[model samples]
Target chain A: MRAVGEGAGGPKSLPLILARELAANLATPMFLIDAGGTLVYYNDAAEGLIGRSFGEQGEISAGQFGEMLQLTEPDGTPVRRRDTPAGVAFFQRCPSHRVLQATGYDGVRRTVEVTAYPLFGTTDEMHGVVTVFWETGG
Target chain B: MDVGVWGCRGSLAAPGPETIRYGGNTSCLDVVLSSGHHLILDAGTGMRPLGVMLDNAGVDEVHVLLTHLHLDHLQGLGFFRPLFRPGVAVHVWGPASPVQSLSDRIAIYLSPPLFPVRLADIPSDVTFHDEPLEAVAIGSATVRAAKVTHQGPTVGYRIEEGGASLVYLPDHEPSLGVTLANHPADWTSGYELACDADVLLHDAQYGDDEYPRHVGWGHSCVEHVVDFAAKANVGNVVLFHHDPYHDDDDLEHLLVQARARWTSAPERVRLACEGMTITLDANGVAFGAQAARA
Candidate 1:
C-alpha cells in the first residue's frame, strides 16, 4: 500500500489522490491499482474480503495479483488480462463489470461480482483503476 | 523499573544445548516497579520459571498482560506454578475480540481436550480484564495499548513507571505501514508508543535476506527493527523474538549487522537474552550482569 501522498515510485498524482480518498471511506471491498498495474491501496473492508491486508502483504504487482487472485471465468477458463475488469477499465479507458471466481491468499474461493473504472486526472489522463467487488456466495 | 527477559524466542520453545545461551522459551517478560509491583508480559513457556521464582519469593499477587492469545504465548499458563498456589491472586489482561471476552478467549486453550485443566479449575483466584485502548493505571505503572500491524488483532504495549518507560512490541511488521493508505494514523501509533522510551523491545525475527519470504508473517527483520528504533529515538533497543531457526551464533552475527546500521549510539542496540535484566531509572538505562555475558 503506497502512502496517500505517494505513488508507487513518485509523488502522488491528482487521480491517485482521488483514488486514495475514495478507498478510504469505502465500506465495501475496494482496491486501487496504479497506472503501472501495481496495487497501491486496498481498504479495510477489502482486506476482510481478501483474507489479508494489503499492508501485511505489501504491494502486489499486476502479475502477482493475477496469480494470487486466480480469477477465472464461469466456464473454468482463466480470465485473460485484457478481459479482466480492472484490465478492461484501465487499458480500454472505460467502466467494466464481471462476475468471476476469485481465490484469496488463504485459499478461500468465492464467486465475486466486480465493477472496475479508470480514475482520470484533470487533463483526462488515466492515473489508475479502482475496483469494487463483493463475494456473491461461497 | 527493572525488566527481565525470561524467554525471547518466537514461535516455539527451543530448549537444547545450542539454544541455551539465548534461551528457547517463547515470549515472556517480567517487569518489576521500584514500588514492588510485579507485572508479567505474555505467559509463554518462560513463565514457568518466572512463576517458580515468584512463588518461592512469596509474592502473592501478580498481574499478567498478554499481547494476544497465540498458542505460544498462552502455552505456559498451564505450567505456571503460581496459579496452583491457593489464595494467590492472578489478574490477566489482554485484548478482547468483538464477540468474545478475554477470559473466554483464553479458556478455549486452557480447557479440556486442548489442555488437561480448565481456567476455572486453577487453584488461584484469577480474574481477566479486557485491556482498554487508552492508558490505564496498574499499581504504580501506567500502560497504554495501541493496535499494531499483525495477522490478528494484536496490540503493542507501553509501560511507564516513575520517569522510566518501556515499550514492548515483540510481534510487529513495519512494512505493513509503508503504504499507509488503509489506515494512515495507525502507521504512527507504534512509533508514538516507543517514542523516547528507556527500552524498546521489538520483534527482530528475520534477517534482511530471510524477510521477503516471511513478509506479512507479523514479524520484523532486524533492519526494520533498527530503523524503527532509531526513528523513535529510544534510549535502548533490545531485539527480542528470535526466530526458532536462528541459533546463538546467528543472533550474535545479526546483532553486529543490526548495530552497524544504527547511526546513532550503536551501543544502545542489544539483543534480548534469557535471564538478562535491564534497569531504567533517573540515572539512565543500565544492563545487568547477563548482558555482559552476551
Candidate 2:
C-alpha cells in the first residue's frame, strides 16, 4: 500500500474534494490520478482489488505502476500506459470504459471492467481523472 | 399528475452555496397521481429530504421506479426514513439483471459493513420487482419502460394517465448507437418514449463543446435533447440531470441556448432544478414556483 503525503498534488488539488467524497463512499474500486498521471489516491475497495494498501507503498507514477502490474488486453496483449482508460480520459478530456486484465501488486490476476472519467474544476479546467473498476470473473 | 424535482444534479450530490439555487442533490423526483398515489423516481441523495416530507405527511406507501442501479441513483435508499417505519410499504421496480436479482444487486450495498443495517432489518414491507416487458398499471396511470443506450443495462420510462403523458430518460447517449452502426434500431426508442409526452425530462448533462469529448459517456448535450424533443413533438422538454460543475447561471445560459436551437415552440423547453414542480392534466401543463422549505 502507498500513501501520498498530506500536501501532495491530490489532496491539494481543486478536484480533491470530489475525489475524496468518491473515495469514501463508492463501493466500486476507485483510483484518482493527477493530470500528469501520478497515482494520487486509491480507496479501500481499490486496495482490495490491487492487492496492496495505499498506506504502505506511497505514491507511484503511472508509468511505474503500469510497468509493475503489466495491464494487458483480455487475450494478454500488452496495453500501453497512455491507452488505459485513465490515460485516455485525462488526455482526451473525456470518459472511457474498457475491460482489461491486470496483474496486481501481489501477482494475482483479475479481469476487470474499468470506467474512467476526467475530473474538472469549477472553472471547467481538467484537473485529474477518476477511474472506477470492478472484477468481472471469478 | 404532479411532479416535484427533489434532486437534479448529476454524477453526485454537490451541496453548497454555489449549488444552492439549482440544488445539490443527485436525482430524485416525487410524482403524485390524481388519486394521491406516490411514484418516486431514482433515489439520489435528494431522497433524504423527500423521505422527511413523506414521513411528515404520513404517507405509508411508495412506489420507486429506478432507471438503473447506479450509485447516485440508489444511494438514498438507506437513508429514506419511510423505509425504516414499520407500517410503511415500499415497492422498488427496476430493470432486470441476467446475472443477479434486482434486490440482490441493491442489497450488495444495503447490507453488511457498508451500512449499519441491512435491507431485511428495515421495518418497512419493502419489495423489489423486475419490471415487466409491457406497460404496467399503478392506480390510473400506466408505466412503460424501454431500453436506452448507456454503459450498462438502462431503461427510460413513460407514464400516461388521464390522456396526458410524461417521459423520463435522464441518462442517455444517442450517438453511441449511431456510431456503432450495429445498434441503429435502438436509436428511435428514445423518440418513442417522448412521443406526445406532456413533459419530457431528458438528460442534458453537457453543452455542445463538452459533448464531443464525452461521446460515449451515456449523457446527452442540450442541443441533442432539444432536437429530439422537437422531433417527438413533446409538449414540454425539461433539460435534466445537470452536470455537477454547472452552476445555476450556467444552467440559465444552457436554457437560453436550448431555446434558440429548438426548431419549434422554443418556449416549451425548460431546465430541471431542485424544488421545481410541474403539473400535467388533460387541459395542459403548468409550472409551479419553487416550493418553500417546510
Highest lDDT among the candidates is held by which one? 1
TM-score of chain B of 1: 0.94
Q: In TM-score terms, which candidate is top?
A: 1
Question: Model 2 TM-score?
Answer: 0.66
Q: Which predicted model would earn the best DockQ?
A: 1
Candidate 2 lDDT tens digits, B1-294:
899999989898988888877889999999999988999989999999999999999999999999888988999989999999998989999877657889988899899888889877889999998764368998778998765666676778898889999899998775543432232221244655667888999999999889988977989888778766766778899999999999888989899999999746788888888889998998889998554744
Q: lDDT score, residue B123, model 1? A: 94
Instruction: List runs of model 2 lying over 4 Å from the truth.
Output: A1-138, B177-186
Model 1: CA > 4 A from native: A1-138, B177-186, B290-294
lDDT of 1: 0.81
Candidate 2 has which clashing residue pairs, if any? A1-A53, A1-A56, A1-A57, A2-A53, A2-A54, A2-A57, A2-A58, A3-A58
